[model samples]
Target: MRLAVIADVHGNLIALEAVLADIARFSPDLMVNLGDLVSGPFDPAGSAQAQMALGCPTLAGNHERGLTMNGANGLDALARPLLSPDQLGWIAALPATLTLLDGAVFACHGSPAGGDEEYLLEDMSTGRPRLDTEAAIRARLAGSGGAEMVLCGHSHVARMASIGGVLVLNPGSVGMPGYRAALPVPHVVEAGTPHARYALLERGPGGWSAQFHAVPYDVETAARQAERHGRPAIAHSVRTGWMPPA
Candidate 1:
């Protein structure tokens, strides 16, 4: 089965549309959104409506959880007013994780054990998201009940790692590619390209294999939208795939 995975949209309908159009040519058997759907400076309601129209299963991200928890925080708080009651409810109802392909694949916004906040394949000790050891990745998956493939987002960086023969894949971010955050430590996640990112996964006789795709879209438009929303930092990040100093 071919599955297309997208995550961390964070609004930006233009990027979402462009990515969807690009994915159409591949004609994937399944498409999944890894959530953080409408938590940004762009058109939150529009992005949410468009993603929901895709009719795919969505797993909640940290932003979604934040909104659901308190409805006040970061971009999610700013975007919440733009979304309808139903849209907010839909996002709130999304599951934190999903098991698919009859247990062949496991999907989550972050590490299986830590929900949407943990870094599954990243070691943040350096204050930036860098690849972690296979043993470390395996420990994060320990509570996940092993599968042939594990899919995750939240780091907003495209990466693949093998843990105990299980393939771990992160498709990266769809809308917001570069951003600085103070998590376990102050760090920045950058895709190093201003393109909508996603991943394609397929199961074959040998094993499960994955492909990462970066689709170019109207970055200028997304940037303008962010600027209009009074988020110049997000605008800079969207345009250059690099976070500007605050």
Candidate 2:
């Protein structure tokens, strides 16, 4: 089966729309949203509604937890306005994780034991972040029996790594990518035009192979929307996938 895995859609309706349009071309068996459906420049409600309308299976994201927990740490002022009671309710109702039929487990934000707000950056030092180890990740999958793959997001950094024969995939952030900055950090890809990022997991005869896809959208339009909503920084970052130097 062909499954489209999407994550970190931080309320950029334009980007999400573009990605959905692109997904239509592939016609996968299922569209799975890894979460962070809202909490960005655009309407979180709109994004959540759109995903629900598409009948896609969605997991709870960190932003969703923020909304549910009333701790809007990462959200900007513009994102605050777009959130309504109904939108918050939708986010609160989302499940933290899901297991697919093909032994593929999907977590909206991170590993099962780590919670939804963990950042799984590959370049971190040995014990800097207190993140999960490879053995811990394998232990998380032990309950799944035949499950060989784990899909997760929330770091906004795209990567595919194997831990003891099990594959862990992070599709990256679709609306706002984090690792595409112009910094000297490892795993930092050169900043290019902001585009929608996603993954296509195809089950081959041998095993599952995942292909990462980036689709360019109308960045100017999205930027304009953000600016109009009073989020200039986000708009600027969306136009060029680089966060301004702090």
Candidate 3:
């Protein structure tokens, strides 16, 4: 069966819409959101509402945690006001981890080893970066009998890695990307391309294949919306995938 996995939308409705449209073309049997649905450039409320409308399986992202925790450590100030009392209550109700398909594990923001705060980067060359080792990552995924696949997102980078035959997939950032460092000055540039990023996982007799897909969308309009929202940083980030130093 074909399953679509999306992550780190960051409240960019344009990107999310584009990605969903693309996913529709694939005719996926099921759709799952890794997390970070809202709390960025576009409207968080809209993003959350849209996700609910999609009726897809979703996990709680770090930003959602922030909303639930009332502007916790991991959340940025820009996302604070987006959460009304109702939104906050809804976010708080979500679980940090979820077990899908009877055992397939999924985390909205990070791994079980560190909740929503962990960063599962591709490399751990420096003797492991706390929650960076494969074994440690797998052990965390091995909750109550283990899981065949562990899906997560938080770094805004796209990657697929196998640890002890278990697949760890991060579908990248749907609204904001930081994967291709060599792309340009703006880490996530807005070239007026109507493209959104996501991943499709197909499980069949030969095993599973993860495909990264980028769907084009109206980025210019999205940027304008970001500007109107009084979010210069988000506008700039959407235009050029780079986040300025605080």
The lDDT leader among the candidates is: 1
lDDT of 3 by residue, 1-246 (tens): 888889888888878988888888989998888777777756777777787778777778767766666435423456667656666666667777777777755554676676775655433343222235676666655442366677888766667888888788887778865322221122322223234678899888877899988776777777787788776665666666555443
Q: Which ten residues in a row have the lowest lDDT in candidate 1?
A: 65-74
In candidate 2, stretches whose alpha carbon ends up further than 4 angstroms from where it belongs are 71-81, 121-146, 179-192
Off by over 4 Å in 1: none
- Candidate 2, 9-116: lDDT as tens digits: 888778888888988898998878888787776666677678777777888876677766644654733455566777666667889888786545544466665567
Each model's lDDT comes to 0.88, 0.71, 0.68
Number of residue pairs clashing in candidate 3, backbone atoms closer than 3 angstroms, sequence gap of 3 or more or interchain: 11
Cα RMSD (Å) per model? 1.0, 4.2, 5.2
> How does model 3 fare in lDDT?
0.68
Score residue 211 of candidate 3 by CA lDDT: 97
Q: Which candidate has the top score in TM-score?
A: 1
Per-model TM against the reference: 0.97, 0.83, 0.80
Q: Which rank order by lDDT, best down to worst?
A: 1, 2, 3
Model 3, residue 111: C-alpha shift (Å): 1.0
Candidate 2 collision pairs: none
Error of 3 at 196 (Å): 2.1
Window of ten residues with lowest summed lDDT in model 2: 181-190
